[model samples]
Target: MTIRFAAVSACALLTLAACNRTQEPVAPASAAATPPVESPAIPAADPNALTAEGLGPVRIGMTRADLVKLWGEDSQPNAVGGPDPETCDEFHPAKAPADVMVMIQNGVLTRITLTRGATIKTDRGFGVGDSAMAIKQAYGGAIVAQPHKYQDAPAEDLFAWPHGGATTYVTDPAARGVRYEIGGDGKVMKVHAGDPSIQQVEGCL
Candidate 1:
C-alpha cells in the first residue's frame, strides 16, 4: 500500500509540473522579427534654380512682351546696339532679382546672366563665388575650358553643354548650355545659362 501511495504521488507531481510548463505563455513566432527601415526621401529641385532651360519664370525663347508682362517693364540704359537694338539687347526686370540680367536676341529671351551679389546656384550645384575646380567637378568632361578674354591663367570661361547639344558651334539654336566666368581670383565672377549667347565674350553678341 505504501509503495502504491508513493508511486501515485510521484505521478501527480510529474503531471502538475507538465501542466505548469504548458500554462506558461508561449512566444509568438513573429515576436523576434525586426521591422524594416525606410529610406529617406529625396529633396525636390529648387524653383529658382538656374539651368540650361531658364531661371524661375523666365525661359529661353520667351518673347520680350511676355517677359515684360511677368516682371513689369524692362530697362536697358546701357544698350550698345550690338547688331540691332531691337534684336540684340539686355535688360533688367524691375521685379527680378537684383543681380539677374536678361538678354534678348531676335526679339526673344536668349540668355540669363547672374552677376555679382547673386546667391542663386545653378542646377548643377554651382554659384558666383564657386571655384573653377568646383565647376569642373560638377560638370566633369562636359566642361570646355576657354581662355579668358581679359584675365590670365586660373581665370577662364568654363562652359558646360549640359543638354548634350552642339559642342563645337554656338549657332545651334536648339542647343542649350551654361558658362562660368572665372575671375583672376580663381572664383566664379558671373554665371550664364541659355543658348549659344552664353558663349558671347561681350554682353550682347
Candidate 2:
C-alpha cells in the first residue's frame, strides 16, 4: 500500500506538470514584425541654373583655356558670326547643355546666353518663357526697364544691377548682372548673364 500510494502521488504530480506545460503562453509568435518608415528623397541640384556670376559650372571671367580644359579637348570652339576671335567669340562646348552659349571676350568668358527653348533659369528664378511682369515682380526695384533694340511696344529689355552698379557706367570687370529679353508677346525670349556683355543686344555682333 505504501508503494502504491507513492506511485499514485508521482503519477498525479507528473499529470499536473504536463497540464501546466500545455497551458504555457507562447507569446503569440511575436506579431509579424513591422516595416521601418522611409524618408522622402531629396531633389537634385539643377545643373543649368543661371546666376549673376555664371551658369552651372561656368563662371564669369573664366578663360577660354579654362573652358577648353573643363569641356575637354573634344569640345570644339564655335565662332559667333564675323566677330574677331581676339575681341569676342561664342563657344558652344560639346559637353555644354543644348541651347546654351558662352561668350569669350578677349580670351575670357564674359557672358552666358540661354537661347529660346532652353530650360536654364536665372538665380532670381526667371526663365526663357517667363513673363515680363513675372520678372518685374521677381526682381522688384532691382531691375531697370529699357526699350528693346529690335522690338517695339510690349517687347523690351529688363536689366538687373544686383550691386547698384549700372552696366553702361560700371567699369568694374567683376560687376555682374543679368539681362532678360522680352518678346512682343511680353514673354522672355532669352536670358543673358555675367559681365557687361549681358547688355549686348546682338550677342558678339
Quote the RMSD, in angstroms, for model 1.
Answer: 4.9
CA shift of 153, model 1, Å = 1.1
* Candidate 1 global CA lDDT score: 0.86
Query: Which runs in model 1 stand beyond 4 Å of their true positions?
Result: 1-28, 31-34, 76-83
TM-score of each: 0.79, 0.72
lDDT (Cα, 0-100) at 110 in candidate 2: 89
- Candidate models: Cα lDDT each: 0.86, 0.80
lDDT of 2 by residue, 87-165 (tens): 8777677777778888888888888888988887887778899999998987888888889988896999999977445
lDDT of 1 by residue, 21-117 (tens): 8566887667676789889988889998999899888898899889888876665556454667676887778888888888888789999999999
lDDT of 2: 0.80
